[model samples]
Target: MKPTGGSVGGFLAAVTPARRQRDAETLTALLQDVSGREPVLWGTIVGFGSCHYRYPTGTEGDMPLLAFAPRKTASTIYLESTAEYADDLARLGPHTTGVGCLYIKDLEQVDLEVLRDILTRSLAWSEAGGSEQAELTVTG
Candidate 1:
């Protein structure tokens, strides 16, 4: 997905050491387990796979889309929205939402089973080219 935010370098500049360390480790393990490929840095706040994207205005683009981030407030997992998973997400754990993303306060507060399920399904949805990045706002 095309990042509508800052450039990769700029984003990286704002990342704290703790956040960067956590994100690096989490993303490394997640990429191996999920996509079986190394995560490519997507602009800034995303570690993604080899997925592609296209906007409704016919602005076609491609990049790794399904990804995650370790924001100051929480760690976010970017998922492709799917109709079938609505109920599952509602019942999964404590979470908030943005335009198209889910916000988990922290991994420790949720069920790993449910989180894994969501991540797995989301990756599938993204691979199928059915999801988009949310216009989310971030705060430290």
Candidate 2:
């Protein structure tokens, strides 16, 4: 999927209730700081920067360098690949993994430093074109 021209604030305001707004804002700031880019709303996700990828099937597209969604149940963090960061994930506090996403109930439930480390690693991987090397894994 490709990004749409939506406003980040509008999307956050729409999806996040007041209870979760602070966490969403915190994530936005952290992602922006780690990525060194501004945020863009891609559908319901808040994405920072972008990366281009071409698949083996001769398909290619641009995707967020980093992105996340503040869902009602949890905050979904879009990592480039969770498989490459087992050590980090092991110490990432309370969280779950699904393929490329890291799910946390809220910012308070996880360690921010660990989260930042993960984001930093993900950004580096994306920048280095390591997406194709990613192996999916599921863990909690």
Candidate 3:
């Protein structure tokens, strides 16, 4: 499927104007303080980082060091494998999750400290090879 946001604007453009403006401003400030760089476009996702991923099937791709997307239904944060961090999620405020996804009503509802910790861990995990990420998505 085509990415919601076009090339120049990136996925941020796909979100509603108000939400987009809010997320954009938040992301800009966050990245500046944390990652120290601006977000990049990953199709419809807003990503940060210089990391990449390679699969056992031989498919290889690059993604931001960290990334999140604001979709029509809900916002998605691609932190890391929920499988490896199940216990962390349990203590991470109120969140409903999936095999590889974390569903949150909005950024405010979740714990920012825990979220930042996860984001930091996810970057380290991604840099460490991301084998866990692939495993987290595999279903028997």
| TM-score for each of the candidates | 0.67, 0.86, 0.72
Q: Which candidate number would show the highest TM-score if scored against the true structure?
A: 2
Off by over 4 Å in 3: 1-14, 17-24, 132-140
The 10-residue segment of model 3 with minimum total lDDT is 131-140
Model 3, residue 71: C-alpha shift (Å): 1.1
Candidate 2: worst 10 consecutive residues by lDDT? 131-140
User: Which lDDT values do the candidates have, in the order given?
Assistant: 0.59, 0.78, 0.59
For residues 2-90, could you state the per-residue lDDT of candidate 1 as single tens digits? 54455544554566666554554655576458765545565655665554455655565555545777677766666555345677777
Residue clash pairs of candidate 3: 48-65, 49-65
The worst-scoring run of ten residues by lDDT in candidate 1 lies at 131-140
Candidate 2 structure quality by residue, lDDT tens digits, 57-78? 6666667888998888788899
Question: Order of candidates by TM-score, top first?
Answer: 2, 3, 1
lDDT for position 91 in model 1: 72
| Candidate 2 global TM-score | 0.86
Residue 26 lDDT in candidate 2: 88
For model 3, state the Cα shift of residue 7 in Å.
Answer: 7.3
